[model samples]
Target: MREDDWLAARFEENRDHLRAVAYRMLGSQQEAEDAVQESWIRLSRSDPASIDNLGGWLTTVVGRICLDMLRLRRSRPEQAVGEHSPVLADHEVPDPELEAVQADSVGLALLVVLETLTPAERLAFVLHDMFAMPFDDIAPIVGRSPAAARQLASRARRRVQGNPDIPEADSSRQREIVSAFLAASRSGDFEALLEMLDPEVVVRADEAVAARGAASLVRGAAAVAEHFSGRALAARLALVDGLAGAVWAHRGVPQVVFAFTISEGRIAEIEMLGDDDYLEQAELTIIEK
Candidate 1:
C-alpha cells in the first residue's frame, strides 16, 4: 500500500475509540464526529511515521479539540432549554450511525451532571474516569499538572455520583413516567403533567436558557405542569443516558432533551436541555412504542 493509504488504514482502526472519547468529552455526537474528523485532517497533514503511538496521538488531538470547544461553550451565554424554533429537519431520521449511537447511549443523567463541571474538570473526569486514561497523560491536554488533573477528575466524580441528576428508582418505571410526561407534553394536557408530578416538583435549566428570561428554577406541581403543558410535541421517548427521558430530534439530529428526576411514580424534578451542542452530545435511546 502507498504510505498515505497505509496511514489512512491505520487511522481507521482508531475511529470508534476516538469517537467514544470525543463523545464522552463533549457529550454531543455531532461534535464528537467533528473532533474525530479534525483528528484525521491533522494526521493527513503530518508525517505518520514519526508518531510512535498513533492511537494515543489521535486521542490527545481529539481531547484538545474537545477542550477548546468546551471552553468556547463556557464563554458564551446560551439560550433557554426549551423554546420555539423553526423545524430544522423541516421529518424523519434514518441515519444508521446516529441510530447506533442512540441504541447504546451513554447515560443522560451523567451528561447533565457533566455539563455542570468546568471545561478542565470535564476533560479530566471523562478521560481518566470514563476512558481510563492515566492522569499523567491527561495532564498535558488540560494544561494542568498530573496532581491537578487528578483533583479535577475527583471533584467531577463526586458531583456526578451524588447529584440529583442520578435518579434513584427503577429504570423501567422511570421510562414509563417519562413516556407519560412526553404524552402529556405533546397533547398540551396540563392536568396530565400535574398528575405525573409531585406536589413540589422542581424544574432546572442552564443559565443560557435562563438568561433569555426562561425559568432556571421552578417549583410546585401546578407551575411545572403549566410550564410543560403543550410543549415537547416534537420529542420522542428515549433513554437519556440510562435514565428515562425524551429527546427532540430534527430529522435525525437531536435538538433538545427532556431529562427527569422521578420518585415513587412521579416526576420530582425536570431538566430541559436545549443547547444545540449539549443536545448533540447527548446519547438518546429511542424506546419502541
Candidate 2:
C-alpha cells in the first residue's frame, strides 16, 4: 500500500474521537468538523513516517486549532448589521460517563455554563479535568506556564461553582415534568401551569424585541399564565437535550420553540428561541393540520 493510503487509514480510525474532542472545544458541530478537517490537512502536509503516535498528534493539532479559533472569535468585534448566529442542535446524546474520559462534553446546559469561563480556563479545565491531560501538557495548549495552567483551572472551577446556569435534576424526573408541562400547555390549564411553575420563573422569547436581558424576565406564576393567555399557539412536545420543550408552528412554518430548565419538580426557567434559524439546524418542517 502507498504511504499516503496508510496515513489516511490511521486518520480515519481516529476521526470519531477527534470530532468529539473538537466538538467539546468549539461548542458547535459545524465548527468542530471544520477544525477536524483543518487538522487533517495539516497532518497530510507532514511526513507521516516521522509521527510516532498518530492519535495524540492529531488531537494536539486539533486542540491548538480550536484554541486559535476561540481566540480569533473573541477578538472580533460584533456585527453592526444583521448577524447570522449559529443555531444549536438537540440530538440523542451519548452517555456522559462513557464520553467524559474522552473529553466529549455532551450536555447543552454544560456548554452554556462553559461559555462564562475565560478561553484559557476553558482549555485548562477541558484538557485536565475532561481529557485527563496533565498540567504540563495543557500549559502548552494555552501558551502559559504549568503553574499558570493549574491556577487557570482552579479559577475556572470557582467560577463554574459561583453562578451555575442550571441545577442538577434526575433525568427521569425532568422528563416527567416536561411531559406534564406539555399536557398543561395543550389543555390550556392555567392552574396546572401554575402548579408546575416555580414562584420565580423567567421567560424570554427570542422573537421579542427585547430578546435577552434580565429586564425581559416574566416573573411569578400569575405573570406566566397571563403571558400565555390569548395566544393561538399550536405545539408538539419533544425531548431536547434530555429536557422537555415544545415546537410551535403557524401556517406550516415553525415560528417558536421553548426549552425549560426544571428543578425540584417546578419549572425554574423557560428559554424560548423563536427564530426560524432553528428550523434549518433542527431539520424541522411544520405541517398544517
Q: Which model scores highest in lDDT?
A: 1
Q: Against the correct fold, how does model 1 do in TM-score?
A: 0.51
Local accuracy of candidate 2 as per-residue lDDT tens digits, 1-289: 9888988898999888787777767676667779999999999999887888888788888889988977776776572111212233366355343245235344555666666677777778777777777877777888766545765776676566664222445656776776677667666788878898889988865433245332356888788866654342566665543345666766755556666777777988876655432343343322223
Report the lDDT tens digits of candidate 1 across residue range 208-260.
45665678899999998888888777778888766788876778776556778
The TM-score values for the models, in the order shown, are: 0.51, 0.48
lDDT score of residue 206 within candidate 1: 56
Model 2, position 113: C-alpha lDDT score: 61
- Could you tell me the lDDT of residue 53 within candidate 2? 87
Which regions of candidate 1 fall more than 4 Å away from where they truly are? Answer: 79-105, 163-289
Q: Give all candidate RMSDs, comma-separated.
A: 18.5, 18.4
Q: What is the lDDT of candidate 1?
A: 0.75
Clash counts for the predictions, in order? 14, 0
Best model per TM-score:
1
